[model samples]
Target: MIKRILLVTRGCAPDEFVPAWRAAMGAAVTAPPDVRPSRVTAGIVLDEVTPEPRHDAVGQEWFDDEEHLSRYESWLASPASAAVDELFGRAVERDATDIVVTGEHVLRGAPWFERRWRDGGEGLKHMALATRAAGLTQAEFFDRWRNRAGLVGAVPIPEVARGQAYLQNHPLPKAAGDWPYDAVNEVYFDDLDDLRERIAWFAENLAGNEDDLVRESWFVAVREEVLWPEATSAGEGLLPGRPGGRGTS
Candidate 1:
């Protein structure tokens, strides 16, 4: 599967753009002559809580393969071109990659909700883009990540609700520009303080290890706005009163 990551900057304010973007996506998902390519399996939208450069939001879409992604691109250039262009304006940054490894030891209680993000209630989501150290083979890097994942799970940071890690499978297409990093790490927290604490813990524990696995890392804070069918299934245990449900603290 291939996942496309888009960072978008809006010409208008959130009050205006969010609703319009949602409507457009709703149309893409439910309306006739489906604008979304059949190959698309899942997708999510995220608003950056901490602003960076010209970006305000992030979008993720999962597809079956390169062929499917190509078809989707063609659709974007043709049928959905005008609508998207009008909604998003001209500035947008994007990247595509295959997921090599993923783990979510702690499950989030509620399905991601746009309202929570808009209101600043659900804390912050951290996205980390990084590259492997020189002389590190793909196999070795994956093994280290796999091993480290267990430690991440065992640490038990109450503030963190969910997490995932991804490794790029190959060089991304040139249309999106050069792929600067090989891996992506994502984590959710109840607040910026919690996120900072988690980072400090990582620096003390994971980062000090002899492996020196990551060569570079960049962090961003975002509010997640997820779309796609799997989100419902994933929310099964996320109800307010459910055991291990999300903590309000």
Candidate 2:
């Protein structure tokens, strides 16, 4: 499977997109085939909590293969794409990669949604996008990360809600032939102060040790803005009766 990450910037205010977003999400939960890309097996939208240039939200979409993704691209060029385009503006940046490695620690709760932004509690997400050092093969890099995975989880951070790491199969896309990142790690916290503290802790404890594996890293923070098919609790899971199943219609 291939995953596509789209960095979306709004063309209008949050109020303007709320109705559209609600409508789209309602359809996604009830009749996903009507609203989602035909080949999208699963997806989620993440709004950035930390300020950044050009993008406000991050969209993750999973496709079965390149053919599926190409078909979706064709749809983007068609007349039917206007409504979403008007709301989300254009994708300022995009990346496609194969998931080479993934690890998650649920901690006290699991990820859940509450159908609307206002109804859900806010949380901060920390993301680190990085590239491997020169001469490090993909295997070697992933091996090192996997070995240190437990150490990463052991960091004493009381504010963390959930955390995950994703190792991409290849470097991220670049226009000038300079690809600085190859992987992304994400952690969610209940508050901004906690997020800041965690970063400072990482800098003091892990930065030098990580240098052998990563040549560069960029960090960003985001808030959990909204969730569809609202749930009353964290363990309600992504879909009823599906357990961790991909939300495919």
Candidate 3:
């Protein structure tokens, strides 16, 4: 599938932000240049995570293939884009938001909306983004990126090796435009403490691995909400509070 990840920060209170964000997406699914995503997931950034000094939430949407992706991109750049932006502009810190189209590789469990990240939701999510190494092409970078994943280190990079959920997103050279990052790695944890432990483990054991596969990295934590295709059967649990609200459960 063709996936697009949106990193953004809240601009208002949770009450206002959640609803607005949901409404915008509800309309986005069927509106405009006739593009519709098969899946949509929203992640509310956790303050405890000390995000990359910018975005707080991560959003994901998936389409069928490159053709659909290209049409969606064209729609995003057209004058009609204003109407699209205005739909949920007030819900987030617009200027700080970033978007990228990628090819998603699911490396772990499914994404769910069972708990509020703050209230100890199903799991807190960590997103590690990076660029391909200086001398390697995207192909070579992706090939060697997981080399250390099976190494015999005591403190393994849980996010890379094992986790509640892991998604390796590679930014398409043409689809992602002039973006600096080439990959967005997502992993889920039990809580803040678990997140810290895993992060520390990576620093002590796997930081050096990046030197050969990636250029730099940025991390963020978020509480997610499964907005579309509501959990019905695949996920563990559904959002239990406000209709569009996440974590309230």
Best by lDDT: 3
* Residue 39's lDDT in candidate 3: 66
Q: Put down candidate 1 lDDT per residue, 27-95, tens digits, no spaces.
A: 233312333432111122333333352345555555566666666667667754565544444222223
Tens digit of per-residue lDDT, candidate 3, span 165-244: 66678777773357657788777765677776666666576666557676777777666665655544434322322224
Clash count list over all predictions: 1, 2, 1
For each candidate, give its TM-score against the true structure.
0.55, 0.54, 0.74
* Model 2 misplaced regions, further than 4 Å: 8-56, 62-71, 90-122, 152-180, 227-249
Q: Pick the candidate with the highest TM-score.
A: 3
Clashing pairs in 2: 49-222, 49-223
Instruction: Give one digit per residue, the lDDT tens place, for model 2 in 16-131.
Output: 44334333222222223333432211222333333453344444444456665566556556666554443333222224222322222222223332122224434456666677
Q: Model 1 scores what on Cα lDDT?
A: 0.46
Model 1 pairs whose backbones collide: 109-238
- lDDT of residue 32 for candidate 2: 30
Question: For model 2, what is the alpha-carbon lDDT of residue 127?
Answer: 66
lDDT of 3 at 155: 38
Candidate 2 lDDT (Cα, 0 to 1): 0.45
